[model samples]
Target: MRLSTVILPFRRWHDGGADQWRRAEELGFHTAYTYDHLSWRSFRDGPWFGAIPTLTAAAGITRKLRLGTLVTSPNFRHPVTLAKELITLDDVSGGRVTLGIGAGGTGFDATALRRPEEEAWTPRERADRFGEFVPLLDRLLSQDTVTYEGTFYSAGGAQNVPGCVQRPRIPFAVAATGPRGLRLAARHGQAWVTTGDPKLFETGTPQQSWEAIRAQTEKLAKACADVGREGDGPERILLTGFTPDRPLESFEAFVDFAGRHAELGFDELVLHAPIPDSPFAADQRVFERIATEGVAALGG
Candidate 1:
């Protein structure tokens, strides 16, 4: 299984941001991702680091680690502009970039964007709009002229000049939590990244949370099959957040749980360390353990 690391963009740890990325490469992480939020839900930090610039910085620092947004909100930027920026990053990274995106989720600074709370659509509506946006993005990234007409957005014969440096197309992933979103990921994304406290689901005690994730993965697989797309086949199921207090048993259960999903064809499993204010804090020890024993046990 391939493993990656997720980092928050807004913090002092990110101040030496490019150097931090180089450290992740040295730590043997295959990819490094950053969140694209103006402000986090529960904490305030230094000035928000815009996603594109930080990713570009990551590109300059790491030669092999794939760089990307953990999940950028579509509501925050126009699809055409995002496509261009992604292509530019891909070129700078020598085609080592993946675009992970989603409709805006909670803690989103809608007011900061000057979008009223009521104007924010329901998850269903956001999913519908995202459906329209993805195909347009795919076209634009592929250097095709976009002539799309949709309720949320419309464009007329706008050509995306200087296509992505990545051959064929840059890989696109989706961070999904709901059924509609999962279906969208199965159809549109090359991979899906799931975020949650895995301990809530991994303990053998039959919890609703664990059942929900299993059901969601089953539904996602079916959705892919319905659309004639491969679902969680290989390098598709990128599960994040599987940390526990103890290293051995916790890591064992974590690998066991992921292996169950792998039996169902779920592929990549990325364990995210808890976000910390400082990069070398106590929480980082968990990542160190995973980099050593946890990865070896899971065959990462």
Candidate 2:
């Protein structure tokens, strides 16, 4: 399976996120990413940079490593505008861009965007909005001129004259676990990303969590079949942010984790950011060790 790492855009990133991305690429990571939020819940009071500029800079600095937002949503930006931005990013990144999208939750981002209390989105409404958002982006990125008026958005003859560097569009890594969200991924995503059983990750053992995701991955295969997808549904991406507070049991867990994901048909694995400053001095030792030994063990 391919490997990616999400670099949190705090602490020593103000100068350049690219430096970290360069290191990730140098170490043989396939993709590099930043979290997409106006302001994330943890470190809300601390500094946080927008995902686009960070990714754009990452594109400028690196040639081999793919770049993307770990998850962007339609909370503050409309699909029409965001579509153009995404294409431009593809152009800047020379087509090595993947759109990792999700149904945005009610958190600091919603409040910072000034979403009205009366208009607060429930889980269903968030999913509904996301459902409209992805397909609209797909059309806007590929079609020369398009007019769309959905329940949540409208684009009046929007133009994408030259189109994207990637033919129809850049790859979309859609994040989902629910039926509706998974269906959307089956319809539009080149890659389907999941963190497994969302609540279970907080308390379950590593193996347990992996087992849960394996079941969900099987469910996704069924969803693909329902949509008449024959060969392969989409590239499966397992995001390793299930429990951010805890570190993996290092080499053994890392090797087994990547192996299981590959065996279960996952195409890529996205690692959560490790603590920049850890008592064991993890940032340097763990990642490099993973790159040299762990990934080798998994045949990455």
Candidate 3:
């Protein structure tokens, strides 16, 4: 399974930024992901460096680690503008870019964008808009001139200056959890990443969370079959969670979990460390240990 690391810039963990990203490359991490949050939920609002700029900086620093936003909200920026930024970043990264996007969830405030709360659309609407927006963006980014019109957006003879650096097409992935969202991911995304409570595994034998993930995968695979897509369908299915504060007594549990996910046809497992207040002292020993032993157990 491919392992990736996520950086929470808002927490200010790494001081050297690009320099630290280089260090992560040396540690065998394949992809480096980042988060985008306009406001600090309820606490504060400040001049935060936007997702595109931060990704550009990381791309400039690292040689191999693929870069992507963990997930960007459609509410913040129009799909056309986002496609342009992603293509530019892909050029900067030497085709090492993956677009991870999703419908806006709770925590995002559109008021800053001058849109009222009621103006906020439901998750289903956002997903539908995203479904429409992505294909149009893909066409625009892939070709010179494009003309299209949709319910939410329209363009007439729109031509992007230069196409994306990625030869075929940039890899696209969606962060989804619900049924509609999962179906959307199967339809459009090259991968799926999910994180939340463990209740999803509580079945008869206390394996509800794992069962839920399996169920989602089955549903997604059916969607892929309906569309007649080829090759193991989506190449990756990333599961994110915090490691226990205490060391796991039996690594067997994790081994079994990985095997179960593999049986369900997941290609990767990503574990995000809890964000620490300080930069250099985040205590990565646990992560390092998992990389060393647990990865071996899972045959990564």
lDDT of each: 0.67, 0.79, 0.66
Off by over 4 Å in 3: 11-16, 40-48, 196-206, 242-257, 277-283, 292-294
Give the residue spans of candidate 2 off by over 4 A.
11-16, 243-247, 277-283
TM-score of each prediction: 0.83, 0.92, 0.83
Candidate 2 structure quality by residue, lDDT tens digits, 1-300: 677888877655546555778888888888887788877766778778888777887888888999888799877768888888888889999999988999988887665656366556789988989999999988998898999888999999999878899989988999998898888888899999887786775577767776788888888888888888878889998777563223455767677667766888988877755665432235567666776566567765
RMSD in angstroms, all models?
A: 3.7, 2.4, 3.9
lDDT of 1: 0.67
Task: Output the number of the TM-score-best candidate.
Answer: 2
Candidate 1 residue spans exceeding 4 A from truth: 12-14, 115-118, 177-179, 196-208, 230-234, 242-264, 273-282
Clashes of each: 0, 0, 9
Per-residue lDDT of model 3, residues 36-89, tens digit only: 667544224533456688888888878888888777776676767777788789
Q: Ten consecutive residues with minimal summed lDDT in candidate 1?
A: 240-249
